[model samples]
Target: MKKSLLIGATALALTLASPFSQAHRVWIKPSTTSVSGDSEWITFDVAVANGIFHPDHFAYPAERLSVVSPSGNPVDIQNQQKLRYRSVFDVELTESGTYKVFNASQSLVAFWKDEDGERHFWPGRGKTGTVEEFYQAVPQDADDLNVMETANRLETYVTLGAPTADNNKLTGKGLELKALTHPNDAYTGEPIDFQFFMSGDKAQGTKVIVVKDGEKYRDTAGGVEVTADKEGKISLQFDEPGMYWLEAEYEDDKAKAPAKKRRASYVLVFEVLPL
Candidate 1:
């Protein structure tokens, strides 16, 4: 689907009274993270839902998704479709290494009160605007102006044969995950270490949350929360083998003019196999 159309659909979903439309989480799940053979295909489901891995809220924009092959080249996606609650796509893993599937975006948002005490939003709410546009349109003397820059990344990994580090290198922008343990090689009951970075620097004291799939079916939330140490690293272990969602957020005063604060968030869906 086109980017404009997807934004309109998302706005429509948010207009509804349902709770699912409020504060939903974005995730991309792969059919399998690790596969063997000369060539293979991996199907992915992208959604913004209340529950992890559940497509109950709305379909995430398929146009925003991208794939990077192990050779550090852009890979093409196939059969992209936006369904009622989720977006689906296929990736042909012809390369014998890991492929990174992700949806990453950064935008500037602002709210200000005019001299007449009327509130206004830059580019309007639920819409994305560039930093240059924000400075050009917003009034310099605007009252109570609150400007923020947000960077969000939702990603997963699929390894064709042997896992490769080429696809996991940090881009030195926004919030990112650096895996001390390869995502595709994680096993149940084993501690897997991951680190968080904000604008290429180690994001110390960041809070990371992990939620296993099937959250709605369980009585208790059973979610795990860990804090990144001084080194911006956290270790996680899962008792059961299943798909898990990991999310982290960091806020800082590194934003440029017109934006006082910058918020960065990341989400990763990874699979753990039975040991």
Candidate 2:
């Protein structure tokens, strides 16, 4: 019975990661962070870039996209248009409270031949839904057959007006960013605090990369590095108002079965209004 469950889990992981290759990194950025009226339309650009959210890279389709209202109802995005670099869509903000624009993806798997010319593929898990239970379904001592590396990426947006707890809830899946400073309500000078959680626990030592608008690489100017503390928290303070992309990466090469090495990431793109 146990062996059957492990095989089932592995199959599920492969199913989830079958969409894209290993180089895809997904992110979504909204036109505005906050709106004043009860009824307003906001646009978003969703993309999967190879250089870690850079605009120069090609983008994949924005799949399984939805907007969750403050009251917890999911709204479908309408009038989505795909561009060369990103996919753009708009959502009508009917409620006055905060609305979350969330885009999550299945895990992606990649394999490489080892020294003995044997192909290995790591297992993958679903991003938004129950990932822990899936991992627990598989045993640790399983064979390292077809070992591959798996990764998951997620993006979220917050429109501030009404009160909502949707932005801070943790899915307890792969790497996730919980905004402590309220991403929609961020300002230019105030430090934005974010907590990283991996597989339900605090993801300590995760390296966070922040890139301001127009930068192509992570280590360029207007880019900064921050590492998660022991409690899995990182803080960022924007020097001026503009668009910014923040990404956190975590890798565990010694991870047990179901994953050869768990390489995961979380990305959040938001605008900081000038003070």
Candidate 3:
């Protein structure tokens, strides 16, 4: 017996669609962006929801979460649980610096038709499969064969005593965010700069979409869009103090064989404080 498939038809449909246009948003919300104490604890909520910060759809898998300490060390999370609509966890910050909480993943998705002319998908319809499994199960001459590689990251920042840049360094493997302005130091009415990277290089002309919390109460979605400059940087300012969601996506033809394209997406939830 094989394991169940990681993706279903609906999930495959969403994967083929525009990455940024998806209605379901995935995020990790921290109790506080800044804190102080010898040992402070921060609670987090992880969810895939239709509304910002609202966990109405499904809980993001808690097992996929991780925390990086200010010194670039792996920190452990406590009290993790998955409920009906959200996953909750707590992190104990013993170091007096910033922490990076995130969920990052990469996978290959494929579509094809078998000899019988029946449509099929790599990883199949009912169970998960690996690259080797995909190669063995999918015929080399399969009709309409299409394959894509995807990398996605969802992240939030929390500072215990002071912010540190050690843990914010980019891995240079996929799409990533480099904080020119410390994420925990964002303030209302003041501009904060951030740089985007794709496979370690500057992601010039990347489009970044931002939406503040409380979209359910507003008449309009009130989302804002900004494009990265030639330096792969964008500056943002908020009028009111609140939590905001920021996302960026990039697609290219850098994928290896069996995969024609690569799609990378990055998401961050940060707070803006009143001056």
lDDT of 2 by residue, 1-275 (tens): 99667665554444334322234445787777788765888888787565544644444456566678887888878888888887888888887677777655534344445556644444433433234644543333444433334446556676647546565688777788877877777788898888898877899998887777665543556578999998999888887787887877787775555446766767778778897
- lDDT head-to-head 1 vs 2, winner: 1
TM-score, one value per model: 0.88, 0.74, 0.88
For candidate 3, report its TM-score. 0.88
Q: Is candidate 1 or candidate 3 better by lDDT?
A: 1
Q: Can you write out model 1's per-residue Cα lDDT over 41-102, one digit (the tens) per residue?
A: 99999988878878997877777888999998899989999999998999999989999998
Per-candidate total of colliding backbone pairs = 0, 7, 5
Candidate 1 residues lying further than 4 Å off, grouped into runs, are 1-22, 113-119, 124-128
Report the poorest 10 consecutive residues by lDDT, candidate 1. 13-22
What stretches of model 3 exceed 4 Å from their correct place?
A: 1-21, 113-120, 124-131
Residue pairs of candidate 1 with colliding backbone atoms: none
How well is each residue in 1-275 modelled by candidate 3, as lDDT tens digits?
A: 12224344546335323245477888899888999879889999988788887889777777778899988889988999999999999999999889999877666767788878867656532243457866887776778988877677889999998788887888887789999999999999999999999879998877888999898999999988998988899999989999999988887787887788878889999999898
- Candidate 1 accuracy as lDDT: 0.83
